[model samples]
Target: MDKHLIDDIKHVSLSLFNKNFFGVYHGSISARVSASGFIINSKDTILDEVTEESLVRLDCQKRDYRWSMANADVHIHEHIYET
Candidate 1:
C-alpha cells in the first residue's frame, strides 16, 4: 500500500534480475511494511517487472484469501518476520 516501499522492492527485484542473482522464476523479495506485516511478490511475477498488484501484503500472524497469489515460501517469510 505504500508507493515508496513498492518502488524500493521493484528496484531491488530488477537489480537482482539484471545481475543474474535471480533466474527467470527463482527468487523472491520481501520487506517489512509494518510492525505486524510485510509485503512480498506474488507467485509467477517477473522479478524485473513486479507491479503493485503483483505484490501481496501479509500479516505476520495470519493467512487469508489474499495469500493465494503469494509464493509457497510465504509461510517461511511470515515465520521469519514473526520472530
Candidate 2:
C-alpha cells in the first residue's frame, strides 16, 4: 500500500477515535486495495492508536483464514468491496 494512503487511514482512525465515533476496540476501518482485495483494521485494535501493523490484508475472492489479525467484520468489508 502507498505510504500516504496508509497514513491517511491512520489519521482518520485516530480522528474517529478521538471524537468518540469509535471507542477503543469498538469500530473498524477498511480500504479497497484492488478488485479482489482490501486492507482492514484488526479485531480489538484501538482506533485511537492504529498503526500499520494493526491492519490486515484480505483476498475478497477467497475465504481464507490464514490471517491472525483479521477483524471480525472482515466479511462485511469484503461484501462492500464486492459491490
Candidate 3:
C-alpha cells in the first residue's frame, strides 16, 4: 500500500477514537488494497492505539491468513472485497 494511504488510515482511526466513534476494542477499519485483497484491523485491536502491527492483510480469493492474527469479522470484509 502507499505510505500516504496508510498514513490517512491512521489519521482517520485516531479521529474516530477521539470522537468516541470507535472504542478501544469495538471497531475495525479497512482499506481495499487490490481487487482481491485488503488490509483490516486485527481482532481486539484498540483503534486509539493502531500501529502497523494492528493491520492484517487478507486475500479474498485465497482466504489466507497472511497475518498471524485477524479479525473475527474477516469474512465480512472478504465478502465486501469479493463484490
Please report the candidate that would top TM-score against the real structure.
Answer: 1
- Write the number of the candidate with greater lDDT, choosing between 2 and 3: 2
How does model 1 fare in lDDT?
A: 0.85
lDDT of 3 by residue, 28-81 (tens): 788899888899899968888777778888887775546447777777777788
Off by over 4 Å in 1: none
Backbone Cα, N, C clashes tallied per candidate: 0, 0, 0
**lDDT per model, in order?**
0.85, 0.83, 0.81
Which candidate has the top score in lDDT?
Answer: 1
What lDDT does candidate 3 reach at residue 9? 86
- How much does candidate 2 score in TM-score? 0.88
TM-score of each: 0.89, 0.88, 0.85
RMSD score of candidate 2 (Å): 1.5
Tens-digit lDDT string for candidate 2 (1-83): 67887899999998888899898888889998888888999896888887888888888777666355688777777789984
Give me the runs in candidate 3 sitting further than 4 Å from their true place. Answer: none
**Cα-based lDDT at residue 27, candidate 2:** 87
Model 2 stretches astray by more than 4 angstroms: none
